[model samples]
Target chain A: MMLRQGALALAALALTAPGMAQDAVRSPDQIVAAAPARDWVTIAPQDLLVMTLAPDAEGNPRKVVIQLIGAPFSQGWVDNIRTLARDHYWDGMAILRVQDNYVAQWGQPDPGMGIAEKPVPEGLKRMSDADYTAGSPNWLTSSTLRATKEPQVIGDWPAPMLTDPYGDYATFREGWPIAGIQQMHIARQWPVHCYGMVGVGRGNPPDTGDGSQLYAVIGHAPRHLDRNLAVVGRVVEGIEHLSSLPRGKGPASYYADPAKRVPILSVRIAADLPESERPHLQYLSTESESFARYADARANRRDPFFVASAGGADICNIPVPIRAVAAE
Target chain B: MMLRQGALALAALALTAPGMAQDAVRSPDQIVAAAPARDWVTIAPQDLLVMTLAPDAEGNPRKVVIQLIGAPFSQGWVDNIRTLARDHYWDGMAILRVQDNYVAQWGQPDPGMGIAEKPVPEGLKRMSDADYTAGSPNWLTSSTLRATKEPQVIGDWPAPMLTDPYGDYATFREGWPIAGIQQMHIARQWPVHCYGMVGVGRGNPPDTGDGSQLYAVIGHAPRHLDRNLAVVGRVVEGIEHLSSLPRGKGPASYYADPAKRVPILSVRIAADLPESERPHLQYLSTESESFARYADARANRRDPFFVASAGGADICNIPVPIRAVAAE
Candidate 1:
């Protein structure tokens, strides 16, 4: 069994070897050798939601993805709410509920006003008993879980896309894990909750109103949310800010006193900004050498103090580190 | 059967009437009535630790609790962590780790240098993993599990403390609908993973390290932590903050880059401060009238909107609201 596990692990890693070899360090060309520019498409400004709140931890707005209303969205009518986020669209809203553990929502608290918050007025009103609604109409690709796969998926993340046995236990991709459980069929995809992933907040009334208020997944990754909630986007950076706010003193996190509500100064889509004004950025290539190295550093974590190498890692624990892309 | 459920619920409510009347509303005795004066105790400054980070959502230096070596401490840690807080120290620190349907943790990520950035070297360590390490050398609480429980631990929070109505269903805590085989004689008391609960985080060694990185029961409230970890506090106030942090990137949340780590400014015990420096905090005594209303609000949740209230509130979902004390 051990040998088989090992061999299977190695077999899975072979897929990413070519990609890792050419570019492994943290540089502008990190994944340039491995991916075509087509892989770097920018998200549409309307499709992206930039949620801003008074500075808490990272000193930036709490951002999320706002996929368009589509077929996947179970609450049928909501699709008509043509969203245009940048111009103070979802600010100064009321929190519908703060479902402890699952989400802390804020937006149009009342159903009457909730529907009004959407651009297309009478979208959809979910039943009180509905489970979850989908976000976008994008069809998932066959190999979205991993540009490649690995031996086993301890959890949802690919184990090690690229590996250097003597060095790191990973098979490189665009700096993301690509190993494990490829056969299990991860192609069935949706936005799985992780810290900072955003979802439209709803209640017993799943479609009573297409979500106008939103909540960020701030705790453990709520995998069950996959194919369920309309997950718009994730916080590429500055999650610490949102995850440390003072909780609501009222029902469903609608602070008993409005004074407790955090304020929003502004929210903007990164892509909407002028080319010279966007924040410096670069996401680690899921398939890269620096990524593998970083993973190794984390897997073993021998920072002059940690005595043992846990040799294991949770997928949610492995966030694809984003950085300020260097100036040419 | 329905009638019985209503009766039991009413009886449970009748049990908490006296405590609410004690709050004068006007004078409130300043400190005593703010929170249960008897329950209000000091935390040792030696045990205090603070964490400072701008989480994923906002860009602000967020502060949190982190304990050092000497703090699995029973009491007397700081002069007053939140001096203006009512309920005395009851509102000091709050819970942070509510994983969606999992364990909720509470502790400061950083308190002080030694306390903040640790696995502390100074505090007491459980001598061994033996089940008998008692809080006091008195009667040791033996931790065990029920042989058959189902859905069992809906993601880790303890099985709700429930009772059967009409003996048809095996109602349990966590406000879940359950059907199970009973073994009354085998009932054991373990610290349940209810929402807003506080727990300690240990290294793989289990007992090594100080309480620097604190978390809360933001998710489903993992019941497994009960009896396994030391639960020190709860989210008497804000919880949305911790649950909102973007998931950490890397192994078990040890950021791949040390710079990604949130810093700890300081942590002081609530008791260390002078009496005059305490916060005027108030809590709807879990055993009070407001509590009964709060509990009912959760149990039935007949909000004008809830088409269905699930009719059950999990132990953790029942928000234990906290507030600032109104001085006379």
Candidate 2:
């Protein structure tokens, strides 16, 4: 995943104008490739949750890497996730559901089928529904806030402000996609359910499941679930391992057959793993100049394959670039 | 997928207000269940493309049913698809690429490998860049046209009009999702790239693809691809067969090893099949009152599990409900 310097230099020379020869227009990937190394931020090992699934039929290892949401957004559930990983709570749990164009859910469900439910680790944070969104206390003075009170505002804020269907405005915060609504002087923000985002599964209201069960969005961005669920993190790698599983036949896509469930071999935080086995990953900083350009290029695709550049882009469409950092 | 009257009646009584008890607020699925049969429209057999992929490891039949685009949108490509299907152009072709969180492409690629490429049937239509979007000559007289000069406007047209990132407005047209920009006295519209949407794959500009190689959006709604690619149809059933395929290792997720490619057993128009073999399907009419209510429910989740309701929704989020009709 290392950026090729040769491709970067060539793309820079080619990025002059749209409607030029096919090879002249720099693609969004090319724009990201030309980004300076300083714009790349390394993810802390403590924030990485690595879950290992049972080997596939061919005996290939199956591992999924998740990047926990940072402070000021769903951190309570994030803390619980880290604790669960530390306690090996999900070590022997199974993937319970694979809903087509919906989600791939894992971990324990409510007990009924002969199997005894495992007791949750003590001191797991019990978060209220209000915890789903964080209060943006400093937004009144922020220069990034658009002045319009309209339902959707389109302008530059790293990228063109989205005509958000879920909130007044949707944008990136600390390399994470977020949507926020301003009510008078108060503003509340929540993580959105873009594809590959990992969320905590719960049963009914007043019962935000304590991160014992989690699921990854495997299809289109289900924005309806935004303020309804606790999005603890996002699957940074190995999503294919889950997304490609056979969909369940039971109602809500739960596996009807007991043997159909895929088992979780282990779950561990990267910091707990040996240094040699830890994953080295970096994400393009949302605040960096390169990300702004990258986001713009995504909104306006001047790439060779594209005949017309879409004048705008959905917030989810402009995914913050993440890449595996090769060891020196 | 049948409407259960018991659940329908129960949900009807529960549809009072937001923040009510969990059981009282009806979910979007329940609203669709309550939709009258008259509100459901039967898809024409000719519009259905039945693609049979090679059986899986367990020998389970993998049949993907695609509903081709109707009149006034990508019809040229749609006609070509019908011709290709009738001619059995994809019988021995293999899935070309499967880029995770992007697309699952299938068809014959340009010859470079040892295998000779299949000769495309004659009478394949050559399309222009202008055909990517259809002129909305009747838009000014349409009752659904919301009058607003703002970048984004939120109001009910079946559902709340989307704050489209790709265009001035995004809405549903005859059961299909679309976006368009108002340019002075003219408006041009194009089919959007939602999850499961199929598009014609082309090389450079003016190629517009000859309806030979095709791809299905297997991830988030890649709105950036709108107006950039010729959208011909959407996979209405068995998308998991394609979406769950292992990612290809080659550039653009193409299969590096030709052996890994899944072969297409056959591709045919559903009308070409025997009456007993044809799949019967119906989609909720986007213009129906039930559809409007369903779209509203999707935008605002008043269900018990939801503490807060998202005031609006992406057009793709409100998927037109399609269900199989049991054989009589």
Candidate 3:
């Protein structure tokens, strides 16, 4: 049993092999592959965090790349994360918890484990719960915010807005998935919790996390966490390293045995790495024509394997495609 | 870093431990634990599929339990699955593909593997593509189907309907999450592809799978497959065994090295096992008041950890609670 990618395009093109379809009506992967280099947006090195974990059981190196969210959303926590990375604060930390169908969190081990808590670096921002969401930036014009129906035209591009149950509307902005609502002639938007989205883990009321502790969504998108926690960024690559980790047996999936923790070797900002060691990556611009077609194709599958197309897709279903920059 | 379940109720009750909340405004987990025995419905052994995989590298037993969908949805494929299980057709099969953020499929190995395909047992039903969906059952009344807004009342009970992007409406019916639409005064509905939901896998068009091949959703809800493939059941337990398996490197995440495939020891219907070996499981009835409150709590988290509650939840986010029946 197989759900081969680009099956529809292959059949339509009468090709025996996968990924050979070149026509206009192509698979999502094909569309992304055919996207012009001009449509790719290179992520800034300062915005990238390279986390190196201890070798797996087979002694294979494991690295997870996280792209920090830019301005207009959770910048306070994002900045704190950068500070922590720069300070090497998480160097000796370990993955402490992995909840099934939930999250895999890493930070200081629980005090119950008899481990001393490491002090966080100075110069971290103190963010309030209100910082969880932001006033819709200028890019989200008033007209777009006021549109009552979906497929609203945002800026110069006609974004394929989704009908969401979590918010008034769900759409993409600045290469990120966001949900928003119009309130008193103002728009309030927040980065959503899609699979692989990174978030700050905090204690109870009045304590928005300081970013010393972080977690990645490893299962279904836990939308309930949106607006409840500060979404800092998303894992751009190597999520399998965390998602496949053995789940903790303790409450909330915390590792009950201190010895079982997977050690974090180091966390470094891409800019801090040597010039020759930096990893170059780019994402399909959300505003590009290729992305529009890709989003539409995700919602409506014209591939041969599909007997019926889902007329629409949820925000998390249309993940932005990211890839390593090809060597020039 | 933690998302402690029932945090709100614990704080409200001034309890220092989890699961101590007795009040109505408790967490979703608390609500399920407090549900009365009558609100829990036992799943018949005949409908349970016990799949035993080879011991893990650590020699740990790995068993996955699946609950088959009952009447009014994919019953033809469901029956075929039962026949295969009774005939031990998949005893020696191996898990073939595990695509990240997609599915884990197992069936006959690729012809390129040089392994002979086992002929399917006789008397297996040949289902058509039309069986991918079914006419709304008698239980789904016309009034419920025609509701134009959220939280429609079905029968005497009010089901918390969700605003869905893929269908006209999404809600729970007979303890299963479903999406449906009303057309020409007739209702058509099908099971959804939520994480852990199992489905029959087929090749290209007109060859609707005969249940010889099967796959399980291991990531986010791949709703695009809804009405395109046949959803037969869900993994009620031990999904981590599959979700944590090493992802394949071959195209479509098929294991390129045939030696890497995890062997399936056996598949058996719980009813076919010895009486003492049968698993006793129960699920919170979707029609019960406890479920109504749980669903509401899921959509709106009054939990102390949450600063802003999501006003609503998608169908997949509100998974039906299933647990083993304690020995009396």
- DockQ, per model, reads 0.09, 0.40, 0.37
DockQ of candidate 1 (2 decimals):
0.09
**Among these predicted structures, which one has the highest DockQ?**
2
* A41: Cα error in model 3, Å: 0.3
Per-residue lDDT of A51-146 in model 1, one digit per residue for the tens? 556654457445433333223323332232233244345555543444435555666555443235445234344433333322221222223322
In order of TM-score, best first, we have: 3, 2, 1
Say which docking band candidate 1 falls in: incorrect
- Ten contiguous residues with the weakest lDDT in model 2 chain A: A1-10
Cand. 3: chain B TM-score: 0.88
Model 3 per-residue lDDT tens digits across residues B56-129: 98899999999999988999999999999999999999899988778888876656765688988899888887
- Tell me how candidate 1 scores on lDDT: 0.38
Lowest-lDDT window of 10 residues in candidate 1 chain B?
B142-151
Off by over 4 Å in 2: A1-24, A140-160, B1-24, B138-160
Query: Among these predicted structures, which one has the highest TM-score?
Result: 3
Q: Taking the tens digit of each residue's C-alpha lDDT, what string does model 1 give over B101-156? A: 34434344433212232222333334322221123211111111111111112122
lDDT of 3 by residue, A25-125 (tens): 56778788988988889999999999999998889899999999987899988888888998999998899998888899998565676678998888999
lDDT of 2 by residue, B259-297 (tens): 889999999999999999899999998777677667667
Decide which is better by lDDT, 1 or 2. 2
